[model samples]
Target: MSKPRKPKGRPVSGWLVLDKPFDFGSTEAVSKVKWLYKAQKAGHAGTLDPLASGMLPIALGDATKTVPYVMDGRKIYEFTVAWGEERNTDDLEGEPTQTSDKRPAEEDIRALLPKYTGVIEQVPPQFSAIKIAGERAYDMAREGETVEIPAREVEIHRLTLLKAETDQAHFEVECGKGTYVRSLARDMGRDLGCFGHIAGLRRTLVAPFGEERLVPLEKLVALEEIEDVEERLAALDAFLIPPVEALTSLPHVRISDDQVRRLRAGNPVILRGRDAPLPTPEAYATSISGELVAIGAVEEGEFRPKRVFG
Candidate 1:
């Protein structure tokens, strides 16, 4: 008997902002999406813990180049802190290492908000993906190794006490890259004298994409179940957000076809447009038809191609 043919994956390119479900790791989520789309290449902007559920932006093909932009973008998360217990992982996933009977009042919780706001020094959780001397901290931690994580500066644009119950408190934080909500909860508990760990977490927004564009895993799985490959591919494309959308944060300049060809050929070209004399150091160069040609820097009014895209 002849063996069935393996799928010759499609050259899919675009972004899929997945509403990652609880108990699913970011890598698993990416693999599921990539299989559903039958994409040749795939990657995720950032990771969401298996205990956390929220936006996990998966990039395919050319979109992978913009993963850094989305990862560096401001992020918004709503998480719940379960007061009275501290765990090894700083979240409910680990065993309880410490406990407290004290719980702070609403006003007490509110008063502490200011201290967590703005730039703050935070030590990442030992059970984190952070690399320590070429080894993953979490891997080392699980093997019973002592992990000493140094505190690093992280920006917290906003940290508010949304609601406080007797045993749990909800919070919403808008922060820059490197801020760990787990660490935030740990420190908050320490300050409140109650001890706490994250009970739940959800990411609502990652710049250029949010809840509005989030596609749940179930929908992608449904598409994957379809028997016809062509029909499946067509249906999946309907949900793709153009990879170029990731470049939305950067300045953009529309260039003529001749300039597009030159830029794609790795040549610098002088641009003529309203946003000319390119104020931003780097900008997305689009063609007359709005197709992305290259990512380049503005030098004396000339757009020098640094990374050209087809």
Candidate 2:
């Protein structure tokens, strides 16, 4: 019989809320973190553009399993919309596709805010990750192909105008997943009789993770200078937030050792006691010692394991 191939690197597990710097791509950030930690597995909850800087939640090892939860959470962004010119990419990176001499007044921009709030249809930018016929939109855009992109619904929980300049306006927004700030800038300019594109963008929060948890990329790089290998790795590991932290939004239950064993074995465990939680669509079980055991559903007084964790 052939032997099973063992995975490489350390089995480090946790979430690293990275304060990603401008011009740093999300995939690049994940690769940098993985190389620094030498972890066996790593993934990010969401993609942050190279032009944007802010909270990027990265999962190491077992924490990768919980990425979908973080991705589904709301996001908050502070952005600058520069008027008078709209680019194809919807940001400064692309050439201007349309231009106008007019700039919107503060009162006019404020009046436009309500129109963008709540559930509204939005069209993504040409230079977006959205796929068309199994190919990336950005790929087609780079090759000079202009394809008709469809509009879809996105929720903008709140949109606030912070400051307005002669040719630019600063704003903050809290929105649901898949919402595009660049498109907001583009559409708003069109409605205001001025063309616009994103001049700057910085994410302040991703639901469940805020600026408080952000660890700068520079800090992690500094630790690499430690003389001893173990000490360097320990310094890096200290920045990791527990994987359970990512599951705070979900219903949770602490189980006995017996229940933990059964959950790890992919078996259902019966709920006990008067305080046991009511049936839930999704919940997570932790060992008596407070370590995550599995993500499961509680139905008919029993917890059925879905994804077990070590």
Q: For each candidate, how many residue pairs have backbone atoms clashing (under 3 Å)? A: 0, 0
| Per-model TM-score versus the true fold | 0.95, 0.98
Pairs with backbone N, CA or C atoms under 3 Å apart (clashes), candidate 2: none
Residues 111-157, candidate 2: write the lDDT tens digits: 99999999999999999999999999999999999967899999999
Candidate 1 per-residue lDDT, tens place, 1-310, comes to 9999765787888999999999999999998888888898899988899999989899987788788889999999999999999999999889998999999999989999999999999999999999999999999999999898889999999998888899999999999998899999999999999999999999999987978999988888887778888898999988989888999988888899988888888999986767685456788888888887888788887889888877
Residue 229, candidate 1: C-alpha displacement in angstroms: 1.3
- What are the Cα lDDT values of the candidates? 0.90, 0.94
